[model samples]
Target: MRLPRSLVGWFYVSPLMLVLIPFFVLPMVVIITASVLEGDGFGGIMPFFTTQNYIDVFGSGLTFNLYFSTIKFTILTWVFSLIIGFWVAYFLVFHVKNQLLAIGLFLVCTVPFWTSNIIRMISWIPLLGKEGLVNMILQGLGIIDKPLEFLLFSDFAVVVAYVHQLTIFMIVPIFNSMARIDKRVVEAALDAGASRFDIMRYIIVPLSKSGMALGSIFVVSIVMGDFFVVRVMSGGGSASVVAALYEDISVLQYPPAAANAVVLVLVVMLMIGLILRTVDIRREIAR
Candidate 1:
């Protein structure tokens, strides 16, 4: 009377499948369907199938420009966040002798996240604006004669906002991986005449690859999909692929927008797949 093992596994996962099917899979199916349909000049869709939407998306020069801008910001944010997050996690794991204090310090990092992301992003404006605190402080210090125009509503601001928001995603995974390292391994390496840099290069970085890969996935996905921060922070001077998609949807260009969405989803999945190929996350987590 016993059921098959595979059937039992499926039974256990049925609830999750039900949720994903209705919420995730169904929506994706609808989008893919819409992407292949024809759109009227107005805010309507024709009952016809065509590949023109994909063609338009791929043929447009604006598409390349938008992707280029987005990728530039993505790389800048990823590099800076990785550097800062790695050092912060390393400091907490290796230097902090008191576990309670390290935990307290870690909790401090999460305090800014208690507020909404919009609020956190907007908070940078007052400090970075032309007449804001930074400029005022510079003037008072006699360091500059005029207000810095590029601090806010520029590419600098976009990268700063992105790094501030996304660094925590990097920290959590890296911290978890570094925390699991045995202190004895480090001590033995030191006893064997290994330099600090050697220990870091050989032991720490290799073991932390899983964490870095996980964090990179988070940073890359979020940065690529975001539009609001780029639009607002760049003062309409820059746009990302998602921003163009938003504009298309606003103008009732559903088919083209859906096509862009499908392309973006594919690109993101490819990036994540590359990261996964670099590290076996499931096995690392199992350890």
Candidate 2:
């Protein structure tokens, strides 16, 4: 029997709504409520309400700086990851001759996901530390006499750490975009006397804009709110917004933690809203 329009619409949307209600809607409501009130992450919570926590987050200049630093990391990580990732994906999509070889190269990017994020991040310490592999290798090669003290615990290292983790997030979306391009278009461009750059600029590049956008969205959001990477790499979470919340919670400052969580949610939503406005995710990922 043919379902009514309302019924069909309900059938199409109920699953998503069901998932959202629990995972998305409920969590936000509880969190925001917790922000306005007082409660730890466990049982026996306080139910008192106050706006001081929200005010405190805004009033603190240090907190604002931390927020800016996080945003800076997010922006740099996204931009660089996209640039490098797009190039790699483009090379694979249009350059690799053997399809299997191309697929294998793409799979190499995802190997990080198989391991724990904590383990992977800690692994970086040995390579970038003052007495570590990079400095030793450089010294061995007569590159420099002094070990770079700023190598491990600086913004540079933090950004590098983020990019290492985030490049795959950028690459996968771009690769998906490249995969959908009609191969005949590339051949047609070549047949029409197009140069190598012309084929990329005129055909392959234009088609992958959606992928770039998708990758930017994924990379930006993940890097912006990441705690562990910034905490470990930036040295003791000194200026990390996420780590600020971790500190608050560990110290039993539940209200401020909730407030930070609220702010983080809003920031993420703002990012997502910006992305959705730029790219119709439905059409981009439909294939």
Candidate 1 clash pair list: none
lDDT of 2 at 75: 87
Query: In model 1, which regions exceed 4 Å deviation?
Result: none
lDDT of 2: 0.84
Residue range 1-287, candidate 1, lDDT tens digits:
99999999999999999999999999999899999999896878887999999999899998999889999999999999999999999999889999999989887886887779998999999999998999999999999999999999999999999999999988999999999999999999999999999999999999898999999999999999999999999999899999999999999999999999999999889989999999999998888
246: Cα error in model 1, Å = 0.4
Indicate which candidate wins on TM-score.
1
Q: Assess each prediction's global lDDT (C-alpha) against the native.
A: 0.94, 0.84
- Model 1 TM-score is 0.97
Q: Give the residue spans of candidate 2 off by over 4 A.
A: 5-19, 38-48, 190-198
